[model samples]
Target chain A: MDAAAETTPLLSVRDLRVSFALDEGLVRAVDGTSFDVMPGQVLGVVGESGCGKSVTMRAILQLVERPGRITSGEIRFRRDGEIVDLARLPPRGPVMRDIRGGEIALIPQEPMAAFSPVHTVGEQIIEAILLHGHRWGEKKLSRKDARDITVGLFRDVGISMPSQRVDAYSWQLSGGLRQRAMIAMALSCKPRLLIADEPTTAIDVTTQAQVLALLRDLQAKYNTAIIFITHDLGVIAQMASYVVVMYLGRVMEQGPVDEIFHTPKHPYTQALLRSIPSMTGTTRVALPVISGALPHPFNRPAGCPFHPRCPDVMERCSKAVPSLRPVTPTQLASCFLHHDQAEPS
Target chain B: MSDTAASPLLEVRGLQKFFPITKGFFQRVVGHVRAVDGVDFTVNEGETLGLVGESGCGKTTASRCILRAVDPTGGSINYRTRDGRTVDLATLSPAELRPLRAEIQMIFQDPFGSLNPRMTLLDNVGEPLLVNGMSNRNERTARVAELLRVVGLRPEFMHRFPHAFSGGQRQRIGIARALATNPRLVVADEPVSALDVSVQAQVLNLLLELQSRLKLTFLFVAHDLSVVRHISDRIAVMYVGQLVELAPTDAIFNRPLHPYTAALMRAVPPADPRVRITDGILGGEVPSPAAPPSGCYFHPRCRFAEERCRVEAPALREVTSGRFSRCHFAGELSL
Candidate 1:
């Protein structure tokens, strides 16, 4: 868990606590979540909606909205062998502005909302590139030069007829093309870490596969660490090297993708796997739903949040929250079963 | 497969829908966008036929045409109702179609947006019944409660408005509304695509359960292959307003003949992490529906496109007993 190993993590987030000041009380959106992403690693974050996966990823870039603040944790970002504490940086300061897109870039879920309706996609991309390029005292290029690079970036992201597409606004482009434009904009600055939050949710299956493959190839070529957030385990299988299972703002389990998919230890993870419609399995009588919806942010359980829905919940699960214990090599899970066997105090 | 004799509940042939593109203040018709062009398919009684494609590929338009929500410029929609009466739905006048509305219903994609926010859940579900002149409010409320239970929502939720519930709950309300009149055929347009993954399974399961219990025929439109495969007994693949492939679910998944279908299958990620994915095959975006490719619409991205494919529009022809494909080289491709 050392942050300074040979494979130094580009982004190391530990004990991240993000909460919202609601009318009733303080609601924990991301409670003590922790994970890491190394160079060229695609860390898949999977969860049901409202499980705080997006909130945890947003916390890294300090993008959490007002009234919902990061209460504790260190988002230690490594840039050019220099480590900077992201959580400690003052909001809107030069240090924060420099690292926002220069070192850490974000590809949001909904491209329709991400890009302005009036602005052409090329202008949006140029703005992102300028943010990073200007950090090194780079002069603003001519309009033609900016347009050329925008076209090039579009082509790099696999948009056919990039020149024609540069003139179109976000509304004119299809869902898949809009997402590709978002990816192009995110990667235009060439950040070390790319956080793609459900990039393919709106697009079709074919477009999703193409975009994912493009992201993988680009990750390899650029050696950019990625924190990919999605609900589809299928997409995770295709993109992630490591997998993180989240529930009710906590890390339910974390391990390598293969291990997590094949030999999932947590009941929640197993239920998730079983819920997926499989090509190999028998015709399902009924989809095995996870029994209940995710807990409301304000009414999160006192103990294990997943205990109510878990089929194999024990008596002790409802009393105390389980800390993430080491289950296997590079695998950790927060469950009462693990706590029972690994009790030391 | 079950050998039971089942009649076609709905038959659509050579269906075409074109929207005019007008420009400037003069409002001159610039060109026609053939949103749905020359599509044919049949849904058997008590079976789910999934229509799947990328957005703007005309699946939604085809469904809308079948329901006459958007009138088709050409072709036939023959519906055999529950009373053993066959009717050419397209030729019917507005007054004539009113009686048949109870036999066919549609569930829209955005459940929240589709339902009336001003109405209570009970009122939304009861609208269809009320429109059909079911005058008893008590009876309507009873039926709504029954539907709520059928869709796995609590009967008490009927009093609440759509904004009060979560996305999954709103979808269930939408389903209950669709089933209020006990329609023989329901067109569910991307029913669960709007919900979360976990909630999607729940809603899908609920739909499947309702279908079996009510013995309803379904036209399920979705873009997700895995979801379509799970619920659909038969599947249709569409591209640029054309039906490229149609077959049984397993047949389409295991032995898709059309190159476009094969490429689409290859594009979907496997559930198992251990499985190796074919590098994304078809490249480039779908051509404009307004002016599709002259020959085969797919030839632009098709890896196996030939000289003939680029010039000749392939027709949808039966390649096997129950499978249809539109590719000239479909015989050579393994699904």
Candidate 2:
């Protein structure tokens, strides 16, 4: 609970480690991940499948399932000039419930399954609003007024014909409409923070673009800190102000969006950036890929997690884990090449 | 630049593939799924034709019909098989299509799912050879090794299982497997979509390099326009169960005729910060193929939809030289 750090970052995570205890042993899904999201700023967490980007966000929500727990770390949420330690809060207590869907709303990857199939989209949105609408008593407005407000929220999220579509079932709606409905539900709570996890992966390219643009516009209008997780760098380029590159349960690098995309310090981040198909007129000759497969959680590497696939691997890289350290004024990387290696110059 | 000046290597004329939607417990024929109502396109020799659309747009079904992997309800699929023999793929039986399978190989979307986990990389690549009654294990090993080398993988890795390789490498293995039979035409369904973005390029470059070296024709189907743009010589945009636009790579990218095509192009997020596309976004999802709206399937969500679009189904007609669009007012649309 650092007050001085609260001046800039709305949410600051430090040395966050999330592990799952299975029959095999402890599997570190998120190992010592740390980053900050300033208010009204969009931070893109980019990584491929099972890279722990989602795990890190789940850790913040304290929604990690059984056997998985935050071993050690600090997740501080700055509100009203006071830093609240999220990690210390009980998972299902009264204080936690107030913040879970109220202060921080989540737009999950798949919109179809995220909402209850039985409940109408409006009902779900109303439930979220009811939970967070503290100032309004149980009967702040009549049922009809609440319905009207829900429709308005839906319209704000760009869902067409909100009046009639409000009564429609989730299955009756198209993928795009369902996604917009999910956004409407998330925004209805008036959360200060929004966690969007691969919100566009399932939809078509055109719909994906619309949803991304909508998220950016909504983020600005709400002045909320957004934690955008996605596998697409093109999307991150369009939306993110800051970027955090994760690989095999660790933060490979973190920096400003431009710096991360143009001049990534970490080899993995650079490889990822180069991999994206560019519309920037830069002819993509074959992109460089990490040499080996990602190390699974069960077969965790002894030292640096990405050492097996690192192009600049050394004898020491396999023997010591590199801590997330500052590579530049605004850039941070966890690689032996950047840590204490011989200067190239 | 006349339409009839040159013939396409593989021409699909009014291709239709409909799955019977049985209702009764006795499996009564109640209705047809209309999976591929009527799709028409051509794949010129040695040219990569990119087939792009959202999921369930009949892209996969159309591919299956081309490869004779599935039966088509109607239409003539004129294609040139190996040994420079031209034949209609749709009418051929499995026994007669055996030789054609060697000529028109398919690389499936999921490398992990497509490959047999229990089998070695060498076996997976060499399966076609073995299946074709190549009893010599040593010959299969040599051929598989050469393919591995061609795909930029070391021969030693052939002994390893697919589970050991990265997604990109696994896709290379899939590509090598498809090429093992020396197929002239390869139908690659979302080949790079399964791999990591960085890995996708490696696989794409490998496919491109292989295409040129072997003088192979490709029918690359994918949902990602960016990947399709990089590799395809020509691109076809599909909506619902029909082709909305067909044009050359640059034509499709720069001057799309169909509204759907234009919207899809605009949807491609510009990699650079300077250029911003004016077309806002496609408003809604593609309508269901089972009950596609009358006339043009895209008319429901199309911004330029008009009275003609609601009543008369637009046929694929030449909008410009070497470009085709299916819209009531194809040229009139501002798109």
Candidate 3:
């Protein structure tokens, strides 16, 4: 991103590490990860399950659940020309409460689980606005105002019959409608950053396409920075400007979308790009798979986490972990092949 | 796909499965949800026929009906038996269906739920061999070991429990269990969907290789078109409870005759960034099966829907050679 140097990043994560204490051992879910989300930039985090993509996003929100907590990192968010470290804020503290819904919002993976089944969709969204209504910049925000805003957001997210649909309970609506409602709830407070975690994974493909299009439209209209986390590379191709490929909690590669897809330096990234079946992929031919399976959390490999499954693994990979470094002018990768780069992350 | 044009291994016609909605103290049936309403399709020998649809479209129910997991309300499932016998599976009594069970087996979607958690891999895979008249433990063990190796798993792991394996390994074990009876037809329901992309590829390639190696015919039911396009010889696109289009994989992907099929094609995000989705013709949700709209079930969401489509239901008819479509203006629309 040429424009990256011109302006400050909206959110900067430096060596973020999240760990879960289990009976087996300490599971390093997010191990020494760093990245930047520029203002209005769509940063795509792509990885398979247990790859720590969700943990990294949760770390940013300071919403790491029980048994898991951010071990060490600096999550610097640029708010009103000042950088505030989110890692320092308590999860339930006042600053986090404001930032959770007021500045940074999340469109969670499962809309059915996120929503309260008993409450009507409109009532819940209105409740969010009333709780953080001060961010609306209006002195006296009424329930009626919140209702109107909720209805408008419903319409903005492309829900049919917004007036009547708002009164329907989450269960009364179909999967697609419920997902739109979730997106509406996330954008209710005009959040500067939206963290969408596999928002379209549950819905039908046609509905998924519509949701992706709606998100793109909303992001453009609000210029809200978004961190789209999904395992689908096709979705990343459609929605992201920059891409981050993660494996076993560490960033395997990060670069412009085109570079990451075309000239992936990390063997893991290269193998991943080849493994998926695309719309235009050859039929019946065996996809070159990344051999072996993801290691158990308790048995995370020494040195490079992906060394066990990497196609181009080296002896150095087993002894020392490679730091994220520039492989090309525009791309950075963590591998022995690219360790010769001068600067290191 | 051995002699795929010669004969069909299974044929389903007018398959209908309805669940009643009971209400009040008396539990009076108010309405019926037509889950698999008058669906028809055929699978030839050694061919993978991809039965695909979104949720609530009855793909899973139809697959279940074939396995007799759930009894069908009405249908004729003419399945060719191993001994040159043809039988209507839908009408067969449970006692009669027991023997035919060896001919047809299912691979479930959720790897964790399908396999018994308490059972060891030996018991899980060998249970099928044991029940299918292989009572000798030594014989079952040898066969189970070979089956495990067939699906690319370590034979030694057969002694281990299901919890010890990863998602991909568990699915392989599931495949081994399904193939233990040496079934001719395998109905796999979203087998690879639960695994990661890399692991999903491994499983998919395994399925393809096993099909060709074992000469096994597959009724691959899934919502993913890309995977379907990769493994299936023919693709059947279902909407609501009926098939909207059925054609060869290439034809369905390249020149779909139904608007819904084209809509589904357009919905799949091409991995290339240049082919971004900015606009779509599909709108509205898939209609509730119990309360489907008049005429075509997909008209509400289809961009090519016309006045006739709103009042008159379309019949599945041959539009091109070996291609069937259910649209009033099939093959007429540019879609």
Candidate 2 Cα outliers beyond 4 Å, as residue runs: A1-6, A135-148, A280-285, A288-290, A298-328, A335-345, B1-8, B22-31, B154-161, B273-279, B305-307, B328-334
Worst 10 residues of 2 chain A by lDDT: A279-288
Query: DockQ of all candidates, in order?
Result: 0.61, 0.48, 0.79
Q: For model 3, report the TM-score of its A chain.
A: 0.96
lDDT per residue for candidate 2 within A178-215, as digits (tens), equals 99999988777678889999999988898888888888
Off by over 4 Å in 1: A1-5, A80-82, A117-119, A134-155, A159-175, A341-345, B1-5
Spell out the clash pairs found in candidate 1: none
Candidate 1, residue B318: the lDDT equals 94
Give lDDT: candidate 1, residue A58: 78
Candidate 3, residues A1-345: lDDT per residue as tens digits? 356433789999999999999888899999999999989999999999999999999999988997998989899998876789999998999989999988999999999999999999999999999999988886879999999999999999999899999899999988888999999999999899999999999999988988998999999999999999999999999899999999989898999998888888889988988888877667888888989999999998988898888877888788788888887999989888877432233
Worst 10-residue lDDT window, candidate 1 chain A:
A336-345
Give the fraction of reference interface contacts each candidate recovers.
Answer: 0.61, 0.48, 0.74
DockQ of 2: 0.48
Candidate 1 TM-score to native:
0.94
Stretches of candidate 3 off by over 4 Å are A1-6, A340-345
Clashing pairs in 2: none
Q: What order do candidates take by lDDT, descending?
A: 3, 1, 2
Q: How high is the CA lDDT of each candidate model?
A: 0.86, 0.83, 0.91
